[model samples]
Target: MTPRPGRADGCPAAAGQVPGPQAGDAPYARLDTEEFTATPHAVFEALRAEAAAVPVVVRGGIHAWLITRYDEARAVLADDRMAKDVRHWRDFHAGLVPFTGDVAVAARRNILSSDPPDHTRLREVLLSAFSPRRIELLRAQIARIAGDLLDRIAPRGRADLVAEFALPIPMTVICELFGVPADDRPGIRTWTEALFHGAAMERMAQASNEIDALLARVVEIRRADPGDDFTSALIVACDAGRISSEELASLLRAMLAGGNETTANLIGNAISALLQHPEALKLAVGEPRRWPQVIDEVLRWDAPIQNSLWRFATEDVEIGGRLIRRGDAVIVALSCANRDERAFAHAAAFDIARADRGHVSFGRGRHYCVGATLARLEAQIALPALFERLPDLRPAPGAALRYRQSTMSRGLISLPVQFAATPGRPAATCAS
Candidate 1:
């Protein structure tokens, strides 16, 4: 019996029927649990070959697709037919974990969840604070933060790099950029951590409330005491009627949430990768000029963000020889796309020398990460500084290292390491 047209049973139309330009492939209806837990590279290979636009039935009887191949993923991400706004799909929004208050309200304001005029307006206003010139100016400050963090950790002989250094470089820089007070950092960090990990419905509700209250306070403080910071810049934009107060708050939350954990993970993942691959470290230390390449490789090898935010099909679409009807949920597997053999040579190898750029780690098209330059600056300074300070750094003995258990962000929860201490010396000594 032929499946009824436009009926939502999480199944594609009959064989020989092509739905549209963005339709998904077969074998999607039976997505395996093991697929999510497998080493990311393996999953990438499977998605590239078998399911570039693979369709699957997600929780709550919703039909969705995963775009895996590099070129295909880019097309899907850049294409207007594949929409970022999930509100277009009734089933998609219905399945989402609900939010309690303003945090949930703020989430709706971020550029990631919006389209066209609103997206363009919000991006233009926020771009003023994140311009390349601005990011370059922050380089020296970022370096100082990296240096100070290394100075603190050097005396310990061994330190949990994630907690002691990796996490602080971006967090400190972001706080300074946003005018978040020194005293409020610890509390902000704690709340941010909870929000990132709060994936389930109940936890998400709690996180939403926490973030809402925190941001409300920060906004109030900024209003009373404006200064030369992103928050102040946003306030100025709002005063000019370029953005609404609600939009400003949402943008601020997005900037903080996007910059903090993502950059921290990049640092943590890069450090862990360096420790695991000494040859890469040697190249980085022996020739500091290679830092940019190393940073790129680390990002490709283990991206900080594991998955792209959900995208919805605006109309009937066909991709990879399958048809997907209008209003279906789709997720672009960025981690998988980064390793697509079609786009990258020796896709799985961690070669610092690989001549590869244009990685989708920053994503593509309208919703590409606005903080890419800042993130690169932070990693470029932080990773090299880490190796230079702890030339003999190694993972701590008898301590288990664990990656953050999250599908959203790929990072180490803790990274304990041990090394011989430099006695009676400046805590941090630069080479040459």
Candidate 2:
């Protein structure tokens, strides 16, 4: 396809000479600072009601486009003209540091940041390990982990759901998958948290270094005594000349971060949503089969990953009446897209029974989350088990639920809940 021409306003003019929103336009320029921090549904509604493609100017006068309309957002996400590689940007070299640094590096490790052939190759390699059959085998293990955690916290009468249950469950699973030692789980968790939440570049650098060091150790261990784990499998692939060490490291890092943190946050967010809607919890508890629907609603209501990492425009492209210029950075608001009224009726309403649970929570196209099935399985098993075991589960009185201050993952830091204890079952016995 021939590349579209750039507009006079520096936006990409659509084919057939359609003009996008002009620069300095009030509707396009209005900044919603709260959208960055507010409930995703609220942000979605605001953007839908305002304009289609809003021109958002951030710090240092950097101009990026925000697509709020569902169709437009989907088009942008799937469009071949849009580039996920930051190197395509005019500021490619300048953005390299941030891209490799903590926050961006964490986001970029996955195939989400690559374009075409590279994205296809990287995704194909990882998808082989994360196939549905492989993830299904992990289900029994996940259920046992969830049950074990519940056994520990059930007697406490009151427990922080996030810390006690949600965070540890998926972390354990990811560790097992990666062949990380049980004793080293805490360090990995701390490192991930620090890397995700680190504010300064130095802190991020330190966290990155620590993560690299840990992965190096893991690689060395697998080299000496490889096992039937993803790490070992990756090492084998590298040795067989199927992939380079750098590619192996990137894939492993991506798997660790993507599988661990996102799934944990998804569980935490789902639990919080269930706590807020007791009816939904009751339905899920009574009908375990309804877990699929319940989890979908939870994902739609409170997505774990907020905005997709950044996609730079490869060439001029017009979307939703906005002409985006070549090299422009576009942030696709997945959280916003989930609640778009055009795609979902009564979008803001948290109805688990809603037939249209369409959401971009796992993203779309070639970069969709590889571990999505595993994440869904973990949530399905954990949520029903929690509600079934503790039917009266509710947030503790006067306890304040605090969300983590992050643009990437949206989840509660702590969710204190009070519920009556049920007869205990060994973690291993509870899965069946």
Candidate 3:
């Protein structure tokens, strides 16, 4: 459905209303600093304490409204007045701020950047390719992939989970699912990493170019010799005039990024949480079923993606008493929303058993992450298997946990842990 052109509420962006965030210094917090990236909770707490919606600066020196409270976040996400297309971003259109993704790629319809019928069509096609039945069938393969990864690292008493475990498993699974050739995956991985970690516009745009180029090559290969894979299915849709060639390529790129980056960081975040909270870890390990709850808490506690990309105001709209001008960018701070004291009791604390599992980690409504099920499935299978396979697994002594600095993402750069050294078991074998 198309976003509503304007808010019906009496709260209008009248001249008397305070204007949205300006380019210069703001009275409230600026979220673009590295300090915020490293330790953002305090800032979030203060921002939430102040108001539901606060004007803040993000990366690229862009000024926008950050939705901090849980209720406000849900409202803003579901509110029809908020639009997803970057063309609605006032600063980007005015050339005041750099664009977020590949202009060429975004010109073609993709889930991350498109709105309306294009987004609807692309999402339906994606659902067909990533059906529940297909995800269920891949469960065994995901487990085996996790087992293979742990097997390589179990021999060493200590391992960097981010490298050996967290990152590779998801990358491998997504690549296999898409039928992406092994040789092409390295570039894909590199380009995806750049998209998440790149601080400058040039680098992110460059990565987008590289990803589109590689995806174009892959599309040509899949079209020539089709297979029973996601890419092949999408190619079929493209051939039938259901979607454009650029849409197919752009969607493949979306899968490559979302399937791996989000999942990889999620696995990393879960492990870090478990190690820090022995009580939760013990309960999860003691009872296998609780792994889901534990993973759920981790999603709330430290979401893989901290803040959602910009959702622009289709017209002047009031969000939680603040008047947002037409075209002003708004970001849903999932991290803050999850830990909102108003939403959860002792919200700052991480309690796996906490009854409220309804955090916006995967977002809400139609724009919710399409890969949520797959991410949960991967974490649930991989997490338990790791603890069961490694004895006395704990963080490396004196190894300070470092997080990659990104305004939009919150994930451990590396999770160093030690466990009892043992003779590694042979990895499980499965059919192609």
Candidate 4:
């Protein structure tokens, strides 16, 4: 099946129409700023209060239209007029828009950056590798990974969950899944972190270069001694002319970044939510079946990723009373839409028991995260394993929660937690 139109896969490669150097300023502008990231609800509420589609500035002062209401957001996501490819954007082609080296590289050919026949072709191949059944099969391995992570920090009464647990688990899992050499993973992790956290163009370029260099080496290794892994499969595809070398590298970049970064944030966000709500934590701990519901609520209440990357307008179109000119960028505020009062009752409240929680955390329609099932599976296996090991876990007292300053991804830079100290448990054989 083809990817649904307009959905995001957690990659930041889309851009827009506003031409003014600085038409929008402060408060509403630059959603990546710490102030805006801290409490986006107020800003989104104001936007929703004003109109369904509102223009705003994002990182680097780029202007785009933001969709706040749920129905409007869904419509814009499913609308083919809102194109995923940034090349179609008028401002981008006019050279008014500037993409950093890494973003530009991603925009060239990644599945997250393509549309139509190209997007379908790219997605179908990767989907076969990341199918639901394949993801489900990794549950035991995911649990073991989680258990090992928790074991490492068990002796310490307090640990930065983000560093100790959240970040490494998915990074390790994705690397193992792709058959990336253990020695190369550290460099890959470093580069991936830089690409995500590097706000400046120069640093982003540096990180992108490092990643490309490493991927090139990995490609050679696969060519010399192929293995039964994604990297090898991609290489085989490359040899078969199913895809070009550049496209293979781009796909590898998308798979690594999209698969790992988003899952890491999802785990972090879910744990942070549970730490904040004791009753919810109790429910999760008392009833294993409730963990799925709890996770769904967490996905809705505090989405791992917030705004979708930019989607360029394929043509001049009117949406939600706003006349979006052809080539303008449209950003779906997934976080805001999840909490829209019109779409959800008591939208602001976080209740894990709520049955009607259908938030578009993984996105909606076609371009929905191809790794959505994998992300969910990782979280499902990881969170319970963590809680089961550290039942008394709670946020470290007086330790301020600091989130990474990012518009595309929502995550804590450091999630410090305190739990009862305990001896390390022997590696219990995980279920088959």
Candidate 5:
């Protein structure tokens, strides 16, 4: 049943739940550094060595404790005391958060920002669309999409995988799944990128508003003429009083925007990781059975989502011997936790052969990514298809690798590559 005492705002006043307003501490770490984008694990490693959690300043002057260690990160992600509701954030209550009204709605209305029973209800209805059988049924379509992408780039002998293939596959699949029109998908992708990545931070507010307006329109259309789409299902739930109208719109954005970025990054990251490690690439490309292991190592070594969303304490709690007071927000450094030596041996090294392939990349407990299965299915299909078609994929010489600017999401802005343009489908790289 209900595990902890809730506040007047309906947030749990449990262990991770933050207490009322109190004096705050100066931030000890800044997540906006260039180093974070280039080498985030280094930052996480430094912080973990100091403590499990340390006070940090995120962008927009949001002060919170960054959870670096694996044990603390896992605990805080699942701890009932660490609530997701933005109202539990003391900074928001004090008008210290810089979010505008529209931006504020985006921050607080989604499932990521909600706690039970609202989170419970929203997640229950949302997860129905991502069920195992439904995802498996999509396997053929995902494979077709991957093959079609390769066809377009195979003859070029050179390509920016991120722009040409990796980005479009998930963006296309997810948008179509949600009933988003083909013509409108490109604009939505642009807006979503600007909202999540820091390089385009100047347009963050504009992008948020545009995305919201578009999602609202989608919700309105589904309400009148229902279709075979997840958005339509969410509309029915809204009408059935299963979730609020606000949540319906937010979930649509969450699903569309969140699904696209995570999978896109996963594909790009997997390709890059495999290319860097020739032996691993040989195993992944030459040995079809080990694709799953290759995908797991890429996820753990360089998670698509770096420092993910925030969690606030509804009340005071102690983590790693540090007393985190109520109202203090916490960001779990997923990238750091996955590489934590305490959790996995030789965590720093990217080892595909490691038997302990577990990681918190998609998160844990109640907030675990609903699209985890879909993401995996897409990557499992994408990787083998690319290497099989190209067979000799390798990084373009002198092209420097660059990641997107957002501290929250870790993904390549561009992934340049050179490959052989064979006449027919290249012979299978993996054994049949």
Candidate 6:
């Protein structure tokens, strides 16, 4: 018997019969699992070739399609039919797709998960805050933060760069942006770490509550005593009745994650990439102008955000000659698309000088990351500063980086490195 259209059972459609899941392909359940995070590139490359729109079972056996081809991924991301509104996702609404902790918390309300008017409204409010001019204005401050982080770590000779340098700069910036007091930052960092990195739902809930309480207090204080900060600016908007309290809270939460996690990872990933290629490291360290190119290449080669958040098909749609049933969850492999053989020559190679390196790491269309400029600025300043401070900086001899267990964010859990303990280091030790 012909299966009913949109049936959950894995079967070929009568008209557009696409290939089923291949043998030995890892299940979507592996997302956020240790194995998947360690090495997702190989699998993504395989999928892009074999099945650009591959079907897999996620946690709880929820069926979803993963798009890997550059063209297809961009098309899906820009297609309004493939909406970001989780409210319309049948499986999630039906409670068939179970999400734990931070995933569930973030899905409730945020620009990342919303669609249409809600997305527009949420995005508009924060757009000005992340404008290019604003981000450029942050350059000097970012450099100082980077220098200070290095000063403390340089004396140690050996340190986990991820913990000592990469993590703190963005965390500090985001806290300052949100007007989070210095006293509250440590606790906020703890909550964010648990919320994003922890696997247990119970612990995640606890962290979320703690964060919520802290944010609430910040909002109240901002309301009472408006300051020259992002949160205070938001409070002004709230006072004018442009946004509600709930929306304000959700926006702040989203910014905290967006502002800190991705930027930190970008810095770490860039360092790792350069360290592996000494020539590139020499170029980046010697010529500061090449930093922009290096940053762009790093974004494409080892993206901080590997895959886009979930988007569900609003109706049956044909993509890459495959039938996607309505309400089916679709994820665009941003890292994979950036490395698509069809789009980029020598896709696997990490060449900073590569001219064709426009990547979807910050996403595309209306949902493109609002924090892109800030992230790039932070990386631009942070990378050069670290290299200048410790020109002989190299990865710890035998240490390996463990990636954070997450499908959405690609970041190292730790990155150990050592540099010579030298005083009054020349800013440009390499030949210009």
Model-by-model lDDT, in order?
0.73, 0.72, 0.80, 0.77, 0.79, 0.78
lDDT-based ranking, best first? 3, 5, 6, 4, 1, 2
> With candidate 2 superimposed using the best TM-score fit, by how many Å does residue 246's alpha carbon deviate from the native?
0.8
TM-scores, in order shown?
0.86, 0.87, 0.91, 0.90, 0.88, 0.89
Q: Which lDDT tens digits does candidate 2 get at residues 305-346?
A: 776666777788877666778776676777777888888998
Better of 3 and 6 by TM-score: 3
Which predicted model would earn the best lDDT?
A: 3
Error of 3 at 149 (Å): 0.9
TM-score of candidate 5 to 2 decimals: 0.88
The numbered model that scores best in TM-score is 3
> What's the lDDT for candidate 2?
0.72
Regions of candidate 3 where Cα sits further than 4 Å from its true position: 1-28, 99-109, 427-432
State the weakest 10-residue window (summed lDDT) of model 6.
Answer: 16-25
* Model 6 agreement with the true structure over 108-151: per-residue lDDT tens digits: 77777888797887788878555566566667778777776776
Per-residue CA lDDT of model 4 for 393-415, tens digit only, reads 88888988778777677888899
Distance (Å) between predicted and true CA of 97, model 2? Answer: 8.6
Error (Å) of candidate 3 at residue 123 is: 0.8
* Model 4, C-alpha of 4: deviation from truth (Å): 36
